[model samples]
Target: MTTNEHINSGEWPLWEIFIRSRQGLDHKHVGSLHAVDAQMAIENARDVYTRRMEGVSIWVVESKHIHASNPADAEAFYDPANDKAYRHPTFYNLPDELKHM
Candidate 1:
């Protein structure tokens, strides 16, 4: 069914899918799909996104539950970090023996 049809029919809620590749340490948003619940969403994600078995893990969350900061508010939201110079690694002095750092 088309997206509009699904919405109008109240079939299922949209879910956001995230996949963690076998070689990756973090899960990244892949795409979205409509599912009846979280369990179905994960299963559907595996079938749709991991057809090549490239992903080691899958995460599915209801789209409505995902909240994000607006890009227009980025300047105000992240401005506080700019004033904290001490938070930068360059602000600290590393010992000569700390080669790994």
Candidate 2:
């Protein structure tokens, strides 16, 4: 890619785009694209990902800012959340028949 294509393809990184389909839920990863600046990233992501009325809010994250768990650390890291069942809303067991998830 050209310098105009991104800031630092491997280091400075590309940004990810997220959008909220509704007001009550967290924004979700819709897609990603690179740009020289955040303003351009947002604009580009909006046009590229949200061409339809698929979102009400938008969020952008420089790819580096996100810290994903390494596959090797899966058990040592995410295992705690699993043990701490309180972290989940298991108390409210909704039947599959429920309309709203």
Best by TM-score: 1
Q: What are the runs in model 1 whose C-alpha is more than 4 Å off?
A: 1-8, 79-86
Model 1, 1-101: lDDT tens digits are 55456667988889999999999999999999978777889999989999998699999988878899899998989988988988878978899988977
| Per-model TM values vs. the true structure | 0.77, 0.63
Error of 1 at 89 (Å): 0.6
lDDT of each: 0.88, 0.77
Q: What is the lDDT of residue 35 in candidate 2?
A: 68
TM-score of 1: 0.77
User: What range of 10 consecutive residues in model 1 has the weakest lDDT sum?
Assistant: 1-10
Model 2 TM: 0.63
Q: Candidate 1 — which pairs collide?
A: none
